[model samples]
Target chain A: MEIRTDYADGNYTIHVDYGILEASISEYIAAYSSVHFLVDQNVYALYKDSLLSFVQHPIILEGGEASKSFDAFKHITETLLERGIKRNHLIVVIGGGAAGDAGGFAAATVLRGVDYIQVPTTLLAHDSSIGGKTAINSGHGKNLIGAFHRPKAVIYDLSFLETLPHHELLSGFGEVFKHALLKDEETVRTLMDATRTKISLDMMKPFIISGIETKMHYVTTDEKESGIRKFLNLGHTLGHAIEYKYRMPHGMAVMLGLYFMMYASNEKAARNIFDLDSFRQYFELHGYPLEHLKAIDEVEMMTLMGKDKKNQSSDATGFVLMNDFGQCYFTEIDSNQLKKYISQLKESL
Target chain B: MEIRTDYADGNYTIHVDYGILEASISEYIAAYSSVHFLVDQNVYALYKDSLLSFVQHPIILEGGEASKSFDAFKHITETLLERGIKRNHLIVVIGGGAAGDAGGFAAATVLRGVDYIQVPTTLLAHDSSIGGKTAINSGHGKNLIGAFHRPKAVIYDLSFLETLPHHELLSGFGEVFKHALLKDEETVRTLMDATRTKISLDMMKPFIISGIETKMHYVTTDEKESGIRKFLNLGHTLGHAIEYKYRMPHGMAVMLGLYFMMYASNEKAARNIFDLDSFRQYFELHGYPLEHLKAIDEVEMMTLMGKDKKNQSSDATGFVLMNDFGQCYFTEIDSNQLKKYISQLKESL
Candidate 1:
């Protein structure tokens, strides 16, 4: 299936299928004057022969949050230029979120701007690859430096996910869960039921599409994240803090973040829409490292949360509070209030 | 005079007047929740008291081409983050092209993007500030890394030019001259007449406005420089090569680049539109350092031109060649032909 995105700044399509990577890449190569591939090192190792058959010298990048740094950004851009990447040339980013973010940013700023296609190998990238948001982590914070550069297309081939480890699959599913939560109670219920079974591409494909669509809904309305797009960050405020503090996988952190927010903002109606007990059971069943929530230093997490780009004031941390499924709004909670909630969340977890 | 630009990507006004800096900045400060100033060091020193009155702790930047580096970009973004610059805050860039380019890029990439106002302090900036072409020099070439991020407004306070050194003024005029050449012969003649007399605020204002209008014409029509916008780069191909080689003022190199291209693509109608000899005389009269053209190493220059972002192929260099005023086309000339033209240009110089 193909999902087309209509953003205020740009428009592109997302193609999701079982084994469409080679054909999609070949198509782009035929369309553009030239193509440059920026692939995850692990993905390169896994698919070395097939990748080499198509790409001349794909730029290999370490595939993790750590690789999304200024140094990596410089390396990718410098390497691309050295290889004579030009304006008309397309940069095909074949990796998870890290390679995509850094490589997408390189495509955004290199030669003022160039076109790129996102080939997501991880389930987590299903959400990230759809948005034009490209960034490299600054020393101060994650994704502190970036640009809203849209990709020409996103080719998500699920066959690659077959090689992903259990933890990595869980990492990507975290975002899928967040999307389902943001969508509606029905989606949340369906996603919960889907994950109850052993993870498979067939079980996840529909959720992935729905998740990207939900993300695109906010992104298309506010490409710059000035308004509704902030809704997409429902769990990310605490998610980023957790990821930063514990050096955990992004999606894994986000899953915990979702539980914390749901617990903190546990409105009567929201609880009716999303049952906290069942969600806890799901986490425990999936082995989501709920223990990390108990270990989080409230002060450090609060400090990191305060630095979130979404925050409007220094005194408060901004959050996307969902009163119920399909309903969310941005609110700023004072540090003291937030710290109390953190304590309550830890005790509950 | 105020010139409003209508670019496809964005629209902004260019305010060309004397002593408007203080008022313009004050207006923005009153409007935005908060404001940050990124000022050229020299400009800050000259207007320190006045600037301090309006801005607290202005980010002072080195004012020339050397500062347009990735390191400077990192420093600006890091420092801004350190100082607690948020999304709603405005970044008022007070400098010439280099500072504006670097600072504007920081505004563009920091937090994905933010709004910025351009306070052009040099004549050259009247052109650069309006276009939203923000960039930093890469190891490979000038502006090899950047984005097409527009400013909210450009406060072209002519008062800043009063403090500019002669060469700096010349650098700015190079763009004005290029704009005039891009425009009809009437503009060229009028600009020539204006420059022939003592350079004064009143004398330069009309040309600066006209020059900006000329630039906006191409920019508005083709914001990404995919088509007609290439006309604006008539002199820049060789001009950038000259600037990179000699470390000369941008406009001065452009002035010589203009002369060389005019000579190489010396069509009969074009000569009628722009007199090469008189244009050369204008450069000499204004101390444009034409001897740099004589010092040109053809091979080195060819290599530099080959690396220009505008080039489409390795075998040839792309150039904007004019048959007459307002009539130019993009063409690719082989290295040998370009080198022969370079030597011929050297001999003529």
Candidate 2:
């Protein structure tokens, strides 16, 4: 499948298919004067021979949240400079979200910005690789330091997904689930049905494409997160808090955050759009560690949430809440109200 | 005087006047929910009482090229975070070019970017503050790490230039001279007449405004240095090499570089546009250290020039060369030719 995106800053296409890496990458290589690779270690280990056959001396990064650090950023940029990377040269990032974030940031800031292509390996990256939001975690918070640098293109080869572990798959599925929920009730229902059975690449293909398309809808509308782009942060606000406090996988934490918000906003017309009972069953089946909510200290989580970059002020935390018919809007909730919701959410969970 | 700029990325105003700092800054402070100040140490020391009366606890930086390091960047970001800088807040940078570059970069990447205003203290900053280019030097080269982050406004208080030392004023005049050359011959002749006598604030104002206007022409045309912006690097190609090697003030090095390029490209109808003997006399009158040209090793300078980010390949270095009618265009000069020109330039000097 070929999906084209037109952002105010730049325009690029996303190509998704099984076993399409070699041919797609070769075309890019032929076009650019030179190319460098920044691959995730796991991805390198799984396909080293094939990767080496095409590109030489790839800069390998140990993929995960840990890789998204100032140290990792310094290493990649310095190594690339030592290797004599130029302004015209392209850096192809082949990995999951963390690898892409770090490598993309290096690409963005190196020589004041360079072109790059994203080759997302994990399922979660399906959501990340599309947005121009490249970042590295600062000492204070996740994605606190970054830029809105869009990629030249994204090549998603489903072949890499076959090697993903179950937890990794579940992690990626969380974003897919969020995208579906943002899309429509029918899409969410279809995704829930797909999860009920054993997950496979065949079942994931259409949903992944749809998820990217749905994300692009918001991304294209608000490239810099000034308006509609906030909607995409559906579960991310509280999700980031839980993930940081418990060191949980991003999407699983997002899943739990989504439940909390749904529980908080699940009233009147919102209840019609979001079926709480059905989502709870889905969460239970997916093994999303809901126990984190019970164990989480309300004050600590609230403190973390208060530090969220989205919040406008210390007294209130901003959230993208759903209204009737799944329509999302940004609103500020005070600390007391949020604390109340957290306690109630923990008990309910 | 107020000048407005409209670039593809953003639009902002540049206010140039004498003693406009307090009034201009107060206006911005009123508009923003909160504000933080990043002031140069020298400026703070010079105007401590006045500065303290306005912004409390301003972040003071030792103003120099050394301040444009990763360490300084980390310090500023961490300090701002600790002080509770929010998205709605603004960072007012009060310094010369170096402080603006570092502080602007911190503003650009912190929380993925915040609005900033530039309060230039030195004459040289007239050029740097207007451009959206914000950066820090890497171990490999100058400005290897940065972003194209535009400022909300630029407040160029001419009063600050009254206390500028002779060398700093000369350094700034180099850019003003370059800007004049890029403009019509009449402007260059006027600038030459202005520099022949004792320098004062009144004499510098028109040149600074015209220089900024000339720079904005190129910047607005190509916000990202992909096309016409290359012309603005007229003296910068060799200027950067000399500055890096000799630890010279930026514009002073640029003055020498401009002389070399003019000599290299001087021939036929080009002679009508450029007067080498007159320029040499101007350099001598201004106490520009032209002997550095003779002292510079050709091979070492060539290697340094080769590493310039603008170069297309190792074989040929890219330079913005002037045509017969003062029209500037980018061209690649082979290393052997560049080396030969360097020796000839040294002899001519």
Number of the predicted model whose lDDT against the real structure is largest? 2
Q: Report the lDDT of model 1 for residue B156.
A: 86
DockQ for every model comes to 0.73, 0.75
In angstroms, give how far residue B174 of model 2 lies from its true place. Answer: 0.9
Per-residue lDDT of model 1, residues A1-349, tens digit only: 9898875546788999987888887877787888888888888888888643566688999777756877787788888888887788889998999988998999999998889999988999998888789999887788989998889999998888888888999999899989998899889888777768565566888898899999989889888787998888988999999998888999999999898878767742345445778888888788888878888898999888877777767888898888888889778888888888888778876
Q: Which stretches of candidate 1 lie over 4 Å from their true place?
A: A7-10, A200-202, A267-273, B8-10, B197-202, B267-273
Off by over 4 Å in 2: A267-273, B267-273
**N/CA/C clash count, model 2:** 0
Q: How accurate is candidate 1 locally (lDDT)?
A: 0.84
Candidate 1, after superposition: displacement of residue B104 in Å? 0.3
Return the TM-score for each candidate structure: 0.96, 0.97
lDDT scores for all predictions? 0.84, 0.85
lDDT of 2: 0.85
Candidate 2: deviation at residue A175, Å?
Answer: 0.1
